[model samples]
Structure formats: C-alpha cells, structure tokens
Target: MNEQHTVPQAGRRLIGLYPARYRELYGEDIAATFAEATEGLTGRALLRERLDLASHALRLRLRIASTDPAGRILAGAAPIALALGVGESLYDQAWYVEDVIRAVSRVATRPALAAGTLGAYAALVVPWIVALLCAAAGRWKPARRAAVLGLLAETAFWELILGHTWQMYGEFARIALLAALVLLAPADLVDTGRRGRWEVTGLAIGAGLPLAALAASDATVLGVFWQSVPALLPIWAFAVAAALLLAHLSARRPDLFRAAGIALGTVPWLLEQLPRRVPTVWAATAFVVLIGGAVALGGIIRLLRRAIDTEPAEPA
Candidate 1:
C-alpha cells in the first residue's frame, strides 16, 4: 500500500462520518483535502486531524455546529428554556421542602422517612439550580454538565423514591428534554441580538408572572400553590410563546428561523404539560393539533409576506 492510496482510503473512511447528504455533496472534495492535508502527517499530528474531522462530522450530524441555523436557534433557546425549567423546578422544590419540613416535625416518630425526604429534595434540586445559574451566567459547558447531573439525580429520585409511574414518566421526559437541549445546543452559537432580547424578556415574563400571581394570592406557603405547579408549565410556555410571537410580529420582516426556534423551545413544556393537564385520550391529539397549528401559522405568515412582496405598485 503506497502512501498515495493509503491517504485516500483513510480520507474516505473519515468522510463516511458525515451525514449522507453531506457526504454526497462534499465527500470527494473533503477526501481530497484530507489527503493533501495529511500527506506527511503521522503520530500525534494524524491523530489530531482525525479527531478534528470526527468532531466536526458529529457536530454537523447533530445540526448543532456553529454554521447551522438550527444550532444557533437551539443554542439561543436552550438557555431560555433552562431558565424557565429552573424556575418551575425551584417552585416545585419549594413544595418538596415544605413537605420535608413537615416531615421533620415528625422526625422523632419517623426519623428515616424525614432524613430520606430531605436527601431526596437535595439530590433533585441542587444540580438543576446549579445548571440554571451556570446557564444564566453564560457558562454553558458547566451548565450542560450540571444539567446532565440533574437528569441523573432526577432519574434516581423517580425510580427509587417516587417509584415508576405515569407522573414519573412525564417528569423524566421534561428533564431529558432539558438535558438534550443543554448538551446538543452549542453555546457559542447563541444569538446575542434581538432574538437574545426576546429570550431574556420571555424568561422574565414567563417566570415572573407566575411569581407575581403567587404573591398576590393570600397563601403564605407553597402548599396552597402545589395544585397549580403542573399548570405552571403551560403558563410559562404561553408567556414565552407570546413574547416570541410579539418579537416576530414586531420585526420588519418575519423570521421563520426565530419561529422555528420558539417552537423547538416549546416542545419540552408541551410534552410535559399535555400529559398532566389533558385527558389521557386527548393528550396525543392535543399535542398534534398544537404542533400543526404552529406550523400552519408560520406558513400563513410566509404566504402573507409573499403576497405583500408581490403586490403591484399603485399609481399616484
């Protein structure tokens, strides 16, 4: 095997890591480039090149590379969604803490139960809070790692403490979605423009409105707010959606990418909420309808924009 033939063969194998469409379009060019680049490379140099190629290919496959619009949108939305999730989870945790405190009141009678409740609360809440703080501060790598830890803690909490149940499935789905977004969305691609402002405003309104409502209520403790915690998911979703819609409508031109990002960000909440709020028989139907409606709305906006663009000029 001469160096010439070996180089192309190795290049071709590396190119195979990309998606089918990518491979079809750029495989030859990439292979040629790879061969030329690695002509005399060996040892650590060759290993580094291979690692770089593999990582780039994986990023493209995940659609989370810096150049991918999906990546930017997801990355921009991930932090916003993480913030909302953290707020909701914190509220939920307050309920858990209240329960723990009450359990502690009876610690003398049931010491093991009280200790277990406190430990469970800590395990479930700490990592998520850490992730949220890290995301808010723009330290996304740590945020992602913390989110993964939170997901693992959540899973253990569900399986060992809560026991496997329908509610557990819903909770797991929400946590898994959050973790996926955190892991998959490249932080460097987060939009720091108008979309960023919209995300910030959405996070504020989504998380704030609920707290305001809670504060307005005469209840002094979270126990009174427990029944409403499930409802908080949809409420936050609605607030964020409304903010994003307002941003889209206010823009000089519609941004389908922004709309798509909004939809993607909403999925976790939608999936988690519908199951909890809607009847079992109607949950799937509602999910489909809501998603279809969003797509249809985007299409309608596009059509309207096209019609305006194609309108004939009027004479004075």
Candidate 2:
C-alpha cells in the first residue's frame, strides 16, 4: 500500500473504536485530520499521532473525556475519591501500628517490625498530606506530582520494606485505577468555580473522617471505637448508596450525573473488597448487582418523572 493510503487506513481503524453515534458524527473528519496530521511523519512522530488518536477514541468510548458531562463529573470527583482511598489506607495503617505495638508488648523483640511499620506509614502519609494541601490550594500540578509520589512510596513500602509474601492484588488494582482517574481528569474542569470548592471540601472531608475517627477513639479511651475502624468502610458505602437513592427519589428530575460521580468515588472501596479470600465471588456479584440496580432504578425514576410531568390534571 502507498504511504498516503496507509495513514488514512490506520486512522479509520482507530476511529472505528469510537461509539457508533460518535463515529457516525465525527469519524470522517477525525480520520481526515489524523491523516493530515500524520502526513510525511514517520517513526516516533507517526507513532505518537496514532497513539493520540487511539487514546481519544478510548476516552470517548469510556465517556470520561472532557467532551461529555459525565467525564467532567468524573474528573471533578477524582480528587475526592483519591482522598477517600488514601484516608482508608491510613486508617488501616493506624490499626496495623496498634497491632504492632501490641505484638511488641507481648514479645519485646520486634523492633524491626515496629520501625518498618512506622517508616511505611510515614512514606504514605507525608506525600499524601502534601498532595491534599496542594489540591486544596488549587495547585493541581504539584498535587498530581505529590499524589504520584505518595503512591510510589506506598508501593515501595509494601514490596521492599515490608517484604510480605502475600499481596493485596485488589488494593494494587485500586491504586492503579485511582492514578489513572487523577491523571486523566481535566484540571480545567476540576478546578473551576463552585465545583472546585466543593471538590476541595469533599477531599478534605473524605480524608479527615478516618483520622477524626481515630483521634476520637484514642482520646475517649475507647477500644471499641478503635476496633470499629473497619466498620467505617461499610458505613461509608451504605451512606453513598442511601444518598443516591434519596437523590433519585427526592429530585423532580433525578441527577444521574451526581449519582454517577458518587458511584465513581465509591469504586475504590468496592475494589478493595475484591481480593478477600472468603466471600470473593459474593463480593464481585454484589458489586455487579449494585451497579445494575442503580442504573435500572435511575432509568425507572426518570421515566416516572417524565410521565408525571406529562399527565393532565383534573379540572375542579
């Protein structure tokens, strides 16, 4: 095939990956632009063009690109989700530290484990605090850098410092998903107007809740409260579900965008359940059922609202 023919062909293949509605509307123009952009380009330049086309198509299919409202909501929700996930991890780490302390009191010879646990906690916590501060102050570029560094530190802490034989594969997957969401979210959308303030507040609240729980328990001298840290995950998940249901029921028109954004935020917690040895299949099944039911419930509520709005009222 001629060079001219090959570029257009490659562009068409990439465009075909888009949703049918999207492809039908803009496919030809995108293909032509891709060809024009890649004309006379070769090696890395040509490869870069192709990759960009593919990435855009993938984003459109995912409905998480800036072009879609859903994308904007997801972008706005990403930082909040990141904060929640980090906070949950820190809460777990606090429990781990408590366990280590208890073990040391019993054995009096695990100084290394104690030191390693504290080191790992610091590695994860310090950078995440910086990220949260940067994000709150609207310094997104620095926030992104700090977030990435925090994740890397946590990964190293697990793989090198702790040297645990077993890995939490689900936790790793959740981390990767969080990183993608944070990196892919459009900063312009995430840091604009009232939405930005809400996002920052959500981040602070999401992150602060777990720490506050820890502090409350510690200060009150209540071992039961400390033991209840694990229960907070389920409580958070239930609260999100309740909020979605209430939003759907209470609104004249259900806000699917907000519901979806909330759902995306809870995904990290859902993912954390996946690697559990017991009830693994049940966890996966429950997640699918929960998502399916939410979508169906939203559709039903929308249809009902439309019907009510269209119905004629009786004359008195």
Candidate 3:
C-alpha cells in the first residue's frame, strides 16, 4: 500500500523563504522528505522534524546559490574601501585640527572661523574614528558601511550647506584614491583575519599621518632631511619594476596597478617639494584628477576582467 504524503503548512511556509531557483530545483524533494520524516509523529516529534526540515532546506539553498570565491572576496572588500576613504579624510582633518588649535594658541583669531573649523573637524573626523573602532572589533562589513554613510553626510554638508570650490576637488580626489587603493589591493594583502594587528596598525598610521605631515611642512625638518635623502625618481622606478615583476609571477595585478597610480599621483607633490619647480595650481589639480581617475579606472578594469574569467564557459 502506498502512503499518502502531506506537507505541514508550517514546513511549506518556511521553504518559501528560499530563492525561486532553489525552490524550483529542490522544493518537491524537500517536501517529500519532510512528510516522510514527520510520519507517525505526534506533538514533540512532529515539531522537531519540521524544525530539521526548515534548517536542512535553508542550508541546501545557501550551498547551491552561494557566490563564487572571487565575488565573495570582492564583497568582503567593501568595508576596507569605506574605511580607507574615511581614514584619508580623517588624516587631513587631524592636521586641520592641530592648525586650528595652534592658531587659537598663537594669535587672536576670529571666533566664527575657529567655530567653523572645529565644526568641520567634528563632522568629518568623528565618524571615521568610529569606523576604525568598529574595525578593531572585527566588524568589517558593518563598519565600512557606516563609514560610507558618514562620508556621504560630510560631503553633503560641504557641498550644499557650506559650499565647496574647485580647489576642494583635489582633496576629494585624494580620498577617492585611498578608496581605490583598498578596493584594488590584492586580496591576500588585506589580512581581514587578524583583527588585533590590523586594527592597531591602522590606528597607529591614522594617528601618525598628521605628525608626518607637520614634520614635512617644517622648513627646518625639510632642510635637515632634504639634503640627505636622494631624489625619488630612481626609487619610484625600482618600486614600479618590482611591483610589475611580482604581479607577473603571482598573477596579482591590483597592487601593481595601485602603485602605478600612486606614483602618478605623487608627481605633483614631489614637484612642489623640489627647489627648482614652482608647480602651478591648475596644473597640479589637473594631474591629481587624472591620477585619481586612472587608479579608479584600473580597479574597475581589473574587477571586470576577473568577472569575465569567472564566468562559466558556453557550451560548444
């Protein structure tokens, strides 16, 4: 005698949570399993069978529909990109804060200017600091999303509320470049597993960036170091060659592309520091925009190429 099969209403409802592709493929099999397992069951046994069916069906759905490893890696990178962009802004604001404090300490300053500076720092810097804290706690994805939100908030504040200029575009481009770097860095280099070390390292760098800027700006410090250090052109060339060679061997092109972009971006700053060169503002801005665009574009191209490689081959 054949047994009549009937699916519990609860079981059917739970299975519907799965994707349409999953349902189409495995829905009948799951329902049958649930019916057989729950047969001759009363209160507790029937409840347990239903729960098991729900979990097993969900697991199967996930296993079948999961994204490829490359896609997963790229998705995991969202936080880092968000954090880097936010951190770059914070890095700039740290210096701005110090400058404002120094101004307050040194000479009588306009109250409105000081207030505005402090407000800008608060609006822009605090959220990035929070993002760093979140990352330190091993919350990568959420932290980055929050940081992006904060960035958008600040950008809106400057653009609509306070207003911005073309000169500000250079600063915006620098932050964009930082985001591009995080997005474009080789997946292996990200090290998302080590929360303690990564967090500490990131925080230390964030704290030190402003100090490094101050040191670079000081005439005495520059004079002392400028004479001792060789020009960057040779070092830059060697670094690029090394990056290219490593990328060729490892098939890891992201870092190589990023390094090239950074090298391009550094030209204007390097020229500004050179004693002989008086870099024009418009020229420097143009160079920065181009470098930022190049870096961002390179990242997009790499991502697209990876996507193409990962796509399933068509049947002959």
Q: Which candidate tops lDDT?
A: 1
Each candidate's lDDT (Cα)?
0.65, 0.64, 0.50
Task: Put down candidate 1 lDDT per residue, 2-79, tens digits, no spaces.
Answer: 332445566667778899998888776777677877878899998878867776788899877888888777765676
Residue ranges of candidate 2 with Cα displaced over 4 Å: 1-64, 68-70, 96-119, 203-235, 241-258, 279-308, 313-316
Model 3, 184-235: lDDT tens per residue? Answer: 3333334456743363345335434543464446433335653233332222
- CA lDDT for candidate 3: 0.50
TM-scores of the candidates in the order shown:
0.64, 0.58, 0.42
Ranking by TM-score: 1, 2, 3
Error of 3 at 123 (Å): 1.3
Q: Per-residue lDDT for 30-133 in model 2, tens only?
A: 76677779889989999888877887788778877887886776765576566665565555565656765675675557777766656666777788778767
Clashes per model (N, Cα, C within 3 A): 0, 0, 0
Error of 3 at 38 (Å): 27
For model 1, the local distance difference test gives 0.65
lDDT of 2: 0.64
CA RMSD for every model? 6.5, 7.4, 13.9
**lDDT (C-alpha) at residue 118 in model 3:** 68
Off by over 4 Å in 3: 1-66, 102-113, 161-192, 195-200, 203-216, 219-316
